[model samples]
Target: MLIYAHRGASADFPELTMAAYEGAVEQGADGFECDLRITKDEVPILWHNASMLERAGNRGLIAEMTYKEVSRAYPQVLTLDTFLDYAIANKKGVLLETKHPVFSGNRVEELLVTALHEKKALAKIAVSVMSFSWLAVEKMRRLDSTINTTFLMHKNTPWFQARFSSSAAIGPGMNELRAEPMIAKKIQSLGRSLNVWTVDKDADIHLCQKLGVDILITNKPAHAREVLGYP
Candidate 1:
């Protein structure tokens, strides 16, 4: 299974920052995973929350602030463009998750497709889009059927929803999988890849490997590598 850095080695560095991504590369991760959000000016950035109060210590919502304003508040912030450039330079794969129900509606999907096409990312390295919102995944398919997509699943995600999804892969949280190991077999039975998320524990990492997971998204890439004996 491929080991992807969840928000770029986030256990060691700040999430969605360059330092974290650099740490991921240094730790020998197969790919970089990130959450994408657009600013007021329509610039795609790497961020995970609706409000900047946690990461930036400011009350500004990401959709309400321009890139400049965001930068002023949190200079360590990374943009999609910058992250893509670094990934391309390093020849590393990327998994982009677009946050849904945002103030910008479906603009994030449009901008993401535009950026991927502009960068010709598919021609260079592996790129996949994942989202918890089924509608967002549907919109992504409408925008670009060629792009690979994974429908993220939580505990409450309907099983039928996953069964009917057109995504190439099904991303389930590690907790969900631990509770129901049959999910792996069921997903594989449908000929869809299984990508588990935020897996940090050694036993869970081993379980993922044993279950034949396609991609393992984790906060500690180095630790996962060690646990899986990847080196």
Candidate 2:
């Protein structure tokens, strides 16, 4: 199973920062997971929420500010291109999560696809775009069929519905998995890989392993690797 660092070992370092990503890489994580949003300039940047106040002490929405403005306010923020370049240079897989309720139509997806294409990084890295929005998943498929996509869910969206969609994998929250353990088997039964998210505790790690998930998204990559006996 692949161990992906959620927000790049976010438990040890600030989430979505270069420090966190490099920390995860140092921990021997198989890959890194990130959440993204588009700036006013239409450049994709790594950020988890709509507002930057909590994360960066900036008092504006990411969509309302240009990349230069936002970066000036919060220099720690990393652009999609910068992060992708790091991933390619280090030969690490990336699970890129696109934020929902996108206000810029399909522009975010388009920019992400264009960036990957421009670098010719797709052939070298195992990159996958995931979202809670099925429309985004469809848009990703339309943009590039070869690009892997996953449907993220916290609620009980029927497997039959999502499995038949363009998504090649299912990203279920750890809480959802805890609520219904058998869902993993059902997902695997459909020949879809199971990727669980935000798994940080020891018990959660063991549970994901017992379920035979294809990937474990966690903020504690070092701990997870130690638990799983991964180098």
Candidate 3:
């Protein structure tokens, strides 16, 4: 399985920052994964939370601030454009997760599609849009079926959701997969690929390998490489 850095080697560096992605590349990650959020000015930015309190120590909502304002609040912040440029330059595959239920509605998916189309990212590297919201995945498929989409599953997500989704892959948390190993076969049975998230443990890594997971998302790419005996 290919090892994709979760939030860009987030265990060693701040999540969704340039530093994190840089660390990911240095650690020999096959790809990069990030969470995308839009600012008030419609600029796509790499951010995981609606409020900046967790990462930036500011209480302001990201959707209410422009990119400039966000930069001022947290200078290390990375935009989607900036991240895409870095990924393209480094020849890294990209797995972009569009956070849903935001104030901007489905504008995130639209902007992402526009950016990918303008950048011709599909021609250069592997790119997949993933989301926990089934509607968001469907929206992405509608916006551009050529681009791949993955429907993310959490503890609360229905098992049958993946069967009906338009996504090319099904993403389940490592814990979910551990609890139900059959999920792997079930996903494969649907003719969909498996992309497991945040798989950090050695056992989890072995499980992913045994189950033929297509992509293994993790915070420690170097360690995963070591565990998998990859030079």
Candidate 4:
């Protein structure tokens, strides 16, 4: 099992902040989760929402601006390349989640692979296909079948099982883990790894550890690690 820092140890620092990611690496997080969306100019930036306007202090939308425009708007905001650079320098693995389905048909994987190879970080990370659209994961598989992929789900059902074989693992929603223990077991038995997401409390971390999930995605990885004795 591994501990993945959700949004780069978001509870300690601002979500998606470079400082937060740095903190995660120091705490021995095996990997970090990051969300990707496009800027107005079609440049992919590290963001979790449809826009970054909510988190920006006295700033405009990250999507309404070009890459350079966004840089000026939120100087602290990190582009995908910038974030990956830092992760590579620190040797932190990343679970890059694709937030946009329509535009992420195939280009997302291309850009990510190209950037990782260019920065010599390809083998250090895994690109996860987290879109509601199955087509996104299919595209990713097409891009590179070797790239580890995961399906984000709230439950296990026939629909999920049909596509389950294609994924390397499944990321169960935090709210559904205990309620769907049977489903989790089934997923694990299928030879696919089980990972739980967005767990923040100490109790939840312990519970996830008890379940033997392959990865516990948490906002407080350092604390969760302490609770789990992950180091």
Candidate 5:
């Protein structure tokens, strides 16, 4: 199974920062995962939450602030362009999670596709777009069918099998997989690869292995590599 650093070795370094992503690469992670949100200037940035108050102590929605304003408030924040450049340079795979409540219609999808095309990084590194919103998945597919898409599922989500038929993979929460081990097989039976998220425990790692998950997304990439017997 591929081990992707969730938020780039988030357990060891600040989440979504360049430090965190570089740390993951240093630790020998196969790939990295990041959450994305668009700024007021239509720039896609790496950030998990809608507000920057918790991480940067700035009190404003990311969508309400321009890239320049956000950079001034939080210099650590990384733009999607910067992150993609790093991933392409390092030849690392990236799982980009598009945060919901997007304020800019299809602008986020447009910008991301345009960036990938501009950099010509599509063939250089592996990239997958994942989201809780099925619309986001559809939008991404419409923009670039070649780019892989994953449908992210939480506990109470309804049956999404038909809704995400075009997705190349299915990302279920680790806890959700634990509750229904058969879900993994079910997803695989549909010919979709399984990518489980935020798994940190040894038992969970073993469970994912037994279920034959294609990718394991975790905050502790180095530790997970050790557990998985990877050097």
Candidate 6:
């Protein structure tokens, strides 16, 4: 099992800021998981919101603003390309989540794979297309099976099947894991990995490790590393 820094070391710095990502990479995180969303101009940026961009330093929706305007406003507008170039160069991994569920187009997967392919980092990264539609990930495999794509479950927990299933892995929330421990077992039995989200406490991390989760997404990567004895 490995630990992934969620939105970089977001517990200390502002979430999704470059400072947090750089710090997490410096701390030798197995990978950093960041959220991706396209702005109003269809320019993909490392943002988690589909409509909201308040924390992104503006009041308008990212989908309503062009990249030029968004960039001019928020100097920290992390692009998928920029993020991949930096993360892989530092020898860190990435578990990116595409934050475009309501939108049509499948633009999130397009930009993400394009950036990774351009950088030759797709082999080393895992992307989570967090849509109710599982076809999004299946569509990703149309590009590369070895390129990791996982289904991000929202509701109605599904059973796991290893070889027959098109998906390579699954990602559920911490709350989901607690409600149904069998989900963890089912995933492990299927020989696929399970990655849970947004946890920042030592006790929760310990339990996640105990449950044999393959990846733990956390805000405090350095602290989780310490507790998990990564060093």
lDDT of 1 by residue, 1-231 (tens): 999999999999999999999999999999999999999999999999988999978999999999999999999999899999999999989999999889888999999999998999989999999999999998989999999999999999999989999899999999999999999999999999999998999999999999999999999999999998888
The RMSD of every model to the true structure, in order and in angstroms, is 0.7, 1.2, 0.6, 2.5, 1.1, 2.6
lDDT of 5 at 224: 90
Clashes of 1: 0
Consecutive 10-residue window with the lowest summed lDDT within model 6: 155-164
lDDT of 4 by residue, 1-231 (tens): 688888887888888878889888887888889887777677878777765567775355655668887767677677788888777777667788877543345566667656766776666655454544456666677777877777777554345543454777777777787676666677777788877798887777777777878888888877887887765
Task: For candidate 2, report its TM-score.
Answer: 0.97
- Number of colliding residue pairs in model 5: 0
Query: 32-123, model 5: which lDDT tens digit per residue?
Result: 89998899988899999889999999989999999999999999999998999999888899998888866777677788888889988778
What lDDT does the true structure give each of the candidates?
A: 0.94, 0.91, 0.95, 0.73, 0.90, 0.73
Scored by lDDT, the top model is: 3
What global local distance difference test value does model 3 have? Answer: 0.95
lDDT of 2: 0.91
TM-score per prediction, in order, is: 0.99, 0.97, 0.99, 0.87, 0.97, 0.88
User: How high a TM-score does candidate 5 get?
Assistant: 0.97
Look at candidate 3 and tell me the lDDT of residue 207. 95
Error of 1 at 79 (Å): 0.9
Which is better, 3 or 5, measured by lDDT?
3
lDDT ranking, best first: 3, 1, 2, 5, 6, 4
